[model samples]
Target chain A: MSNNISLWLRYKAKLVVTNVSWGLLTFSSRYRAGMLLLFLGLTLALFQSGNPRFLSYRMVSTILAQCAEVGLMSLGMSIAWMLNGIDLSVNDLANLSALIVAMFLRSIFRPTNETVLLICSLAIALTIGLAGGALNGLLIGYLNIPPILTTLGTMSLFRGISMGLTEGKTISRLPSALAVFGRTTVLAIPTPFVILLLSCLFMYYLFSFTTYGFKTKMTGLNPKAAFFAGVHTKRAVFTGYIFSGLLASLAGIIIIGRTLSVAYEYGTQTYIIFALLVLNLAGIKPGSYDVLALLVAVVLLQTLATGFYSKFLTLQGGPFFNLFLWGLVLVVVLALSRAMERWVSTRS
Target chain B: MKLTRLLRHEVVLCLFCVFVVLSIGSINPAFFSLATIFEVIRGAIPYMLMGLGVMPVMLTGEIDISFVAIAASASLATHNVLIRHLRYQGGLAGYLLIGLPMGAFLGAIVGAVSVFSGLPLFPVSLGFWLMLYGFNLFFISPEMRFDLPPGLTGFYRRFLVTVKDPVVGETGLHLAIVYVLVVGALLAIILRYSTFGRGLYISGGNKDVAIRSGYKLGKLLIVAMTLNGGLAAFAGILQCAFKRFFDPILFRGAELFVIAACVVGGVAIGGGRGSVPGVLAGVFFVQLITRGLVYLGIKPVWHQFVLGSILLGFIVFITTRQKLWVIFGRRKR
Candidate 1:
């Protein structure tokens, strides 16, 4: 018993040391600014509750779910960013896909648990996602429109169609089986979390290992260099939009499945904020897919939200403070990252 | 020759005018009646306000997405203050004085932040937009119902234009129509003749050179935001009075439309190349399309969709100079 206890203590010491070193590395990174925010957040959470336990497991889980859609959306956004363009219509496309999926299920499936119904729903959802992407791709790729303007137009067009179809109403009454998939977990892990994990892994390999990913990032870093290097810039941009559209569709499915409803206003106005935050938090760069980094950001934001909720009960415009702080945080982080890069290079 | 040049250049505005007349004429036939004409002009006051406010900034090649939020906050502040103090029914003039400044202050705060932050206007203004929106949501009942004093509510009716015909008798025209004209004329003069306006063009046309040449670009930016804020407030006050209620979602997507008008007015998105006249024409074009849709009784969703598509088309058309996308024949394979 004495020997076993000593062994356990030694093992625990190693674990503690490992964690300390990892934390230090995080502090030294450009992402250290985000870490600083997380530290501040955790400190506030503790201060407000007089205990670190206030940031409960359920709260973390809820935040992970909140970040999941944005995380998925960001993967596509990061690709677009890597390809030197942005798709402003990401959230709209997600909402449109959700609305389309809900409509399809309601009209055809008739609330079934049958294998066939589930398969059909999945296929329909994926196709609608692709179609939404394809529309953006067509305008941007074939028509040779600037991505900024093309996406802006599609953003409005998709949102209008979504609202028009629903007449600005929510589509609830999702099939119970699908709702189960949305909510169910293996060992307390939600389906969306699992999907998020798999998607991240897929994107990691797509961006890190593939020739296409290499070309995409190269194009983004220096379009002239990439063009001279013989990368098909138009096709790459088109692919990026399609991927973005697909991710949005997946987000829509997850949102509807989780919420069991879809509405015209469901995903409106969230694209820019979520995308901007996620891209910045993930330490966006050419061909870099850091799941750990994004996860950290998700946890940090969620904790901040909780801290804000608990600390300020006053209506003297406290809620607005969070948005202001978040926006400021984004700017500060970007500026700091730029400075840090310069500092690190000088040291090297 | 001058008349011909004017006609040629103002073609878009003329086309819009024709579109408005035809649509209104068909819808109620009475739509072209004296009262209806005045009503249409009165209704267009807000868009004109936005167009005029944004013209100088767009000419500088920057965009402000914070107009609606600033406007909404100003309108709400005025309403809240008026409700507390202006309880005794005040005349139209009384409401205007209180409401206008309330909006201007809110706008100036946004302007100050943008000028000081040294951040891109799009993201920084977006921050202001969200912050103000949150405050507006919580300040009023989240559902956003404001109750004006009987006198103030009645005073707002004076904004309507009154017209008297030999056969039709008298109909009212909104005082807002005059506000639009005055504001437009003021902006036109500044754009055409003022050094301050020239500073805006130079700053937007080339920021590095503007700074190198010793122009106080930062101060000029503040002035732009201040004017934009003031006009936006005026538009908000007018709109809130016209609608007679305050909703959190009021003007939710209005900033985009305002920017669209600026773009359609042939103001380069990159700064330093558009005229006030062009912006006014753009406003007329947007107003005509919206009014026409309304006259056609198009559903609200379809209207939004069409507006979105049209806005997209304009941006695409404006941004895609043929030089940017030349396809080398050999590269296609």
Candidate 2:
């Protein structure tokens, strides 16, 4: 038993050393600069607000809850972008999955059997997501439609189907059981935040330790070369889109759970922008640490949002103000990061 | 044989448009009425203008998805200036002057940014799109609606020509139709016969070759985007005149539809291989599909699904056909 304990300790030491070096290598100067800016912005926001509520536990939970869906979608988007493709249909897919599940739950099951309804709805939502993603993969990988155009077409198609299914209405009266995943607190953290954290951990492992992840990176860097080097480029691209679709579905479930209703237009305007913002904040680099950077970006954005709302509670056109600030932040960060990258390259 | 030679994608599109119209007419004769025809033509004007505007940019192997936002902003600018009765006495000319220049300037800024940043036009335009959308939402009240000035309204509503029909009463061709024809003809001349047009084709076909041939790529991109922005603004102004109102949500998601029309018209998204006529036909085709659905009594909710399917179908057909051609060419060689 002592020998086994010693072996475990040695293994843990090796893991720590490897993880540290990997973090150091991936956390380039650009990422450091981004993190600095993030913290600085947070500090400014906190100072300007001068409200103790800024750092309150409830506020922290709200920010985390608010960012959960966007954070999840951003991870999927980063993967798709790393494959040199993008999934514009992600927002629509999320809406569609939620709508499908909601419609199923409302139409087929009795309210008494809440647990069964939840399980079946989730299972069906995941199936739809897989099918939708696989279709995108087939079109992009096998048929060679440009990713943007394909996603654009699919976005419209998905939204249209959702609209037709729901008849331009919202599906509400979802089972109360979904609230456990969407709205409840788990160990003092919001349930959605927990789900996001779990997803990030899984993503880190998948992208860091898996051969498929290596192949995906290879394909993104150079598809022809990767193919020549025996990487199945098409398969990698296919799986990347499928993974994005699955994550989007998960996000949809969380959204439906939180709101207790599903609408065709839900997340239509915000998810794509938020995902792109997170990707941009991470400098569009593909790596395990990008997941962490995404979480930080989400936190920073959510704080800014909540702070703006609190400070200007009486302001007219609150939505407009928030949107303007989001846009401003996105542009500044993107421009700054681009400048930093150029500066770093010159110095090197 | 000569007729067959001339019957390419544009001709095919024309034929398709005719087929759709006739089919709809068969189902509901009211669809063939002169008023319906004019309505379809008027409805297609904005999309056609956008398609024409984006064609050159797409020809130069770049894209500007911010055109819709630019249009919305331009319209708002015109509305604001005209409503405030700002310093300009030319009425319609004054509004056009304000709107068009603002759009051109924005387009130039987008072009310069894309060139300087070394980023693809997609993300840069997307950023601008978000910014402009936010700006529009912030400044423009959702309730703000404006009627055109009396002089401009008269001119906008003036009939260039009138056609009499006993079945559907009298229908007059509006000045908007004239504007579309004039702009379309002008763009056709510029695209097909001008040296700049040839430059666009060359640059889009092969950037390195164009550079080797002494073309200034950055300048060309700026020019293309500027022209695109100007036309988009014009479309917005016309839309305001036609609808006689300004809504912040007007023309939302129009950029994608305009791009779709261009693509369906056989304008290669990769650039260098399309025509003004093809784009016009594409605009008509898309309008016809939507209008025909209404005529056929199909639920309007299916409109988007059908349009998307058509777009995907065309893309698949074109790509597979190209691949097959390459394969066959290799075999022959």
What is the lDDT of every predicted structure here?
A: 0.70, 0.80
lDDT of 2 by residue, B97-145 (tens): 7899988888888888877776778777887787777778887754557
List interface RMSDs for the candidates, in order: 3.5, 1.6
- CAPRI band for model 2: acceptable
Worst 10 residues of 2 chain A by lDDT: A21-30
Candidate 2: TM-score of chain A is 0.86
Computed on C-alphas against the true complex, the DockQ of each candidate is 0.27, 0.43
Each candidate structure's TM-score, on Cα atoms with residue i matched to residue i, is 0.82, 0.91
Top candidate, metric TM-score: 2
Candidate 2, residue B290: Cα displacement in angstroms equals 1.2
